[model samples]
Target chain A: MSDHVVSRRRLLRTGLGTIAASTVAGCKVLDGLSAPDHRLRHFMERANDLTMAMQRGVLDRDALAQEFAPVDIRQPQRPNGVTDPQDADYVAHRNARFANYRLEVGGLVHRPLSLSLADLRQMPTRRQITRHDCVEGWSCIAEWAGVPLWHVLDRAMVHTSARYVLFHCFDTIERSLSGAIRYYETIDLVDARHPQTLLAWGMNGAPLPVPNGAPLRVRVERQLGYKMAKYVRAIELVDDFSGIGRGRGGYWEDRGYEWYAGI
Target chain B: MSRNTPPGPLVRRHTRVTRVTHWIWALSLFFLLLTGLQIFNAHPVLYWGDQSGFGFDNTVLRIGAVDDRGVVELFGWRAGGMGVLGYSGGAVRAFPPWATIPSGTDLATGRVIHFFFAWVFVVTLLVWAVGALLSGHLVRDLVMDRHHWRGLARDVRDHVRGRFRHAARYGPLQRLSYGLVLFVLFPMMILTGLAMSPGVNAALPWLSEGLGGRQSARTLHFVLAAGLLGFFVVHMVMVVLAGPLNEMRAIVTGWYRADAQEAGDV
Candidate 1:
């Protein structure tokens, strides 16, 4: 027989085998419209169930990742992609060793003020040992000392209308759709008030290094390392984060990172 | 004996569009598996590194430069300028000689291809989904009855014994596997894929946390893709065993004739 003919004959036999299997497989227990599409749907349905369950588990209030010991700190954190802030203003800030650095706290706040580094140093401070979990499959712990962000917000006297605290940093990993140079991150009021959260100025009991967010940075211990905005130059208290980049919460959010980095 | 033949002529089994889509999806999945394995050589699960036994190392050439136009361009350039590797998208390269899959190396090209093809795969799946849902094929063909659940043990016994002759149309195990792949694994892939996207991650911070951050998502993506690959292998093996032509036709044309009297006849 010709190859085509042989193949066709084989097809008939295999088809028969399959049909017998299908019948004994108990598909007739259902109604009887066995088709390839039906099989595909079955797969899709399974995947959907998994996705939704994961979503709920992650977002659910009870689920929490385990915390580690304070002594587990990695000596030197090899900064992931972006190290230094590329913006001219940030470069100028670094040039002066951030002596003249002033963090602008405005936007929906009752008192808009640009507090200098010296002024920030005089505020009430808190220190805590925390870990930095990189999405790159590495983890590092460090002792950080900085003023509580709540203290800064208290001094700024944020408006009651404020719902989101936006951190405007000085580094640019890439560019947002709006062509902004600096990277930004934000947090809701709950995380904003978490005692572990602070505007960290020192790491490992030393003044923050330049590669690290020198001068000042936000330390949100409850979340992943990325949420801890480095080289924080401004804190904008906004009522809504929807007007932000791509209507997502953070700079990286537009690029596909989850808005909640609470690992 | 003639009076025992109560049924009419066997009917045509599969629709044209259905057959085409099935073959296309199957072939695409095959290509995807091969490329995926090669790409994953960067991070081989067991004994994958420079000192490993498999001893294959693939180089990823990432190209990024500030062009004369003052615009920074990113694209994959050939490694050693050997020009053996072809560039597909922005700032990516795939060099052969992969060991186990290298971990912590750039799979940006793999990622891009994976993402691009994912959309195609998803679109195809969606088409199949919509067709099934509209035609009510799924309700009749897929939904397992109590008897099917009861027969699960027997099916397992049959499958293990290489007696899967009855699994042609839609067996309970097959249905269950398909269900999990479609609903559980596919969505996991999509969500994890989306979770890894910096753009998406930045927008949906919750996803990063949910999927254990961007890197974690990448890790999960690889693991899940591996699972799919396993499924594909077994599927192909079954096709081979069940008689390739018959299996292909059944999936394509959706017709098969099985006689009780001619059980063991050639």
Candidate 2:
């Protein structure tokens, strides 16, 4: 019995030693792999890509964001991240009540039309009461009235080469060493042409407030609130966003947030 | 009393697969909780309905603090009640560093760690569930029979009297708790998690709506996690109470020696 107990203890010790050794070795290997950036984050990025693919492949491309009734509009849309713009151009436009404001729809487009807010409102419009989910774990529902982004794209005559629609906002979210950078966001043609996607100019039965990106804002309803870029200035259609603002795609995307904020 | 009778010979209790899966679950769940708490610290308030934010009065629970500035400032909202809601003090900080992953306030890192282990937790659960079902572990061992209910009541009574029976199979309480964890809590956790995702919501809009709303789903996720924590605490206490060495041996090495009297009955 004594011998048996001794042997069992030895076996357990050997097993524990092997496990400890393997753990140390694994740590070393992981440390080696994590040189450039965090290895875990690298894996997370791949996971994010897989999620995007799964979402696109499995779910209906035209699936609309869930809309609520008028009674369901709970909170007055809370302004998030750079509510007011201090830029000279934006100030001039705001001072004039955006009369001189022209939404330049150029880039990979044929017509390259510069439409005014009145022109956008005059075109075919859609109104929706949808929930806006923030990355910070909050939600708000409000009525939004706008022209379908597809209509604007159609009028601008988006070129066949245009694979993505980029929204360049007038609000300067931050001023960096490089220069004063404005907030920008991008979505593929699939989302841009989604029936619910809108270039919203009205909110809660009233003209869009300055605090709520008056005159224009893009509502990519199927995405998180951040993807709905406020303070709309221009719409540029491009094949790739590699050259745009730090290159990860959108302003927040450049700051380590997922480019496809679908969730 | 047959006190002279020899104790039962050691018998296998847990299978190798069961032991491995159990350890994996234990480890992954620990990480998930820590990481989840870290994520929760970013927005330490939970609400019901379609919307929640600054102007909304739909807060159901909140965790925050007040400072020496005499400002009864709150991080998310004033505590729903005293200690029931969350940690509150002179300087309010909901879920301090030790309680959260990465040991600091980092939502991005928290998310990454949480998601990575989330897949681990999911995959291991699937494998264990499938294995359990195929091996009849779910039916033969975990599931309680009608007779077991009578035994369960007796066992509870005995437990209250500080009497414990050494048995080869799990008692009724164990089976019921295990069943709840396997059939209800884990699945609810996974479903509520998926409901939070906009992509998943797009695929199945009814999921979030059925759960009340996105914010409600988040609230449910936190509540379910707390329920699991309760289970964990009870489970640990039970393990300790049942004789840690014996229970640990049974789970780790699959061998358990039943008391002589119980052994003879079996």
- Candidate number with greatest TM-score: 2
Off by over 4 Å in 2: A1-36, B1-7, B53-56, B68-92, B257-266
Which candidate wins on lDDT?
2
User: Which docking band does candidate 2 fall into?
Assistant: acceptable
C-alpha lDDT of residue A224 in model 2? 82
lDDT scores of the candidates, listed in order: 0.59, 0.80
Tens-digit per-residue lDDT, B1-266, candidate 1: 11222323334445554566676676556435544544444333221111112223222222222221112112223223233222222322333322111112333223333333555677777887788778665665567789779978887887776665432246677767777776688788778766643334333657756775444565677678778878888887876764565566567667644334333322
Q: After superposition, how far is residue B197 of candidate 2 from its true place, in Å?
A: 2.0
lDDT tens digits by residue: candidate 2, B37-123: 878877787888667856756777776544322212243433332432244343344675556665555666666667777888888
lDDT of 1 at B177: 79
* lDDT string, candidate 2, A1-263, tens digits: 59987887677668768966854454334333222267666775666776678789987766878888998875688888887889898889899999988998999999998899899989998999988888878888899999999999998889999999999999998889988889999999989999999999999999999988977998988788889999999999999998998787899887667778786
